[model samples]
Target: MTVPLFPLNSIVLPGGRIPLQLFEPRYLDMLTRCMKDGIGFVVVLLRDGAETGAVARFHPVGTYVRITDFQQLGNGLLGITVEGESKVAITRSWRQPDGLNMGEVEVLSEEAYAPVPETYAELTSVLVALCRHPVIQDLDMTVDYADARQVGWRLTELLPLDKQEKQRLVELRDPVERLSRLQELLEALESG
Candidate 1:
């Protein structure tokens, strides 16, 4: 399926929510079309270039996201909150005349449900503590502690991890593997 691409410096995994301030004509147009068509777009991390102006080079893997809520911010730019619905791989991409990037994508299958292992049980508690913060609470996230995917995605979202590291987590198709990778990162963070 072909979809509009919104390249950012960050990675948004499945079940993550991100708010974007849209001021560019290309993206504003894209938003209108997406909402009208009731179709979501792909959010990918940029490998090069900035979010505005020149067309950015983005990673092939991205999260297919749907707009969940929207509001008119005081600054006048359109504010929209989107939730990642599924992972997608961009097989091809091109820049439109308006500077919007479009991609021919394949939606990846959802990871099989795997329970959070006993060894990683402590990660769930860390996530619970992080969620109490006002910023996370504002997102109104629904987390399932028993699910390995949720634990990995939520931690990756809230942690101050590098973008490349987060991208690696997002690209992993296995929930257990993602959790194990996350544990390694957490350990590194603590030891360093």
Candidate 2:
């Protein structure tokens, strides 16, 4: 399942809302095409040497996202809402004529009901509290616990962490390991 690519330093979890400003010509073209085709694109993390047009350095794990809403901001900037649909891996990437990057992506799917560790339930409660904290309360959000197995991904994105840490979360395949790592992150944030 090849799809277009939109590289950012942020993690977008399934059922999450990511607002983006599209001003770059290539991305504008990508957005237009997505609207025309009724399809979405993969949101990947930009790795080292990205500015040099290095296609080989992007993170493999990404989220397949759909454009749920769009509004034209002044100065030709587009305010777009991206709703994550699924995970994907980058097979390849190429530069499009309009300057936006496109990629050959393979969508990844998890089992319908992967067992989540008991500890995750506790961690999730903490995360819910953190989301409601006064500092982050104005972020315009909601709590989605539809997939317990994906709670780690959602936390990784919600936390104000560095891109490297989020990338590590995306690469982790084991649910238990991912949950443990997320717990550690939350603990660290709480202590700080």
Candidate 3:
């Protein structure tokens, strides 16, 4: 299916929530159509260039997201909260006349439910503590501490990992492998 692509330097994995402001004309139009049609859009990680003006290069794998809440901020910008639904692969992309990026995409398969392994169980505990922070509580994320997929994704999003590292994790289809990678990264973080 074809969907609008909102490229950013950051990556949001499935089950993650992100707030964005719509001010660009093309983006504003895209938001209107998506909300009216009750469809979602793809948030791809920008590989090069900027988010506005010229067309930017973005990673093929992206998270399909739907607008969950919206408000007109006091500054007059339209603030919208979007929740990630699933991962999508962009097969082809092009810019419209108004500079909005559109893409032909296929939704990636969801990870099967896998319980967190004993070795990485500590990661889940860390995630639980991170979620208790007021800033994270505001996102209202539904995380299952026992599920490997949930534990991997929530930690990958909440951790101070670089954008490329997060994108790599988001593209991974295996929950266990993702968790293993996170554990290794966390270990290295502690050592450094």
Taking all chains together, each candidate's TM-score versus the true structure is: 0.97, 0.82, 0.96
Could you give candidate 3's per-residue lDDT for residues 34-89 as a string of tens digits?
A: 98999999999988999778879999999999999999989999999899999999
At residue 43, candidate 1 shows an lDDT of: 94
* 1-192 per-residue lDDT for model 1 (tens digits): 999999998777788888899999999999999999999999999888999998688899999999999999999989999999999999999999999999999989999999999999878888999999997888887899899999998998788899888888888888899888888888899899
The all-Cα superposition gives candidate 3 an RMSD in Å to the true structure of: 1.1
- Model 1 scores worst on lDDT over the 10 consecutive residues at 9-18
Local error of candidate 3 at 6, Å?
A: 0.5
**Per-residue C-alpha lDDT of model 2 across residues 1-192, encoded as one tens digit per residue:** 778878786768676767888876677778888899999998888775453234435688898999988999786778898888888888878876655677888877663555566767876776677777664464455655545555676677777877898888877766568788888887788899
TM-score of 1: 0.97
lDDT of 3 at 163: 83
Candidate 1: regions farther than 4 A off: none
For each candidate, the alpha-carbon lDDT, in order, equals: 0.91, 0.75, 0.91
Question: What is the TM-score of candidate 2?
Answer: 0.82
Instruction: Name the better of 1 and 2 by TM-score.
Output: 1
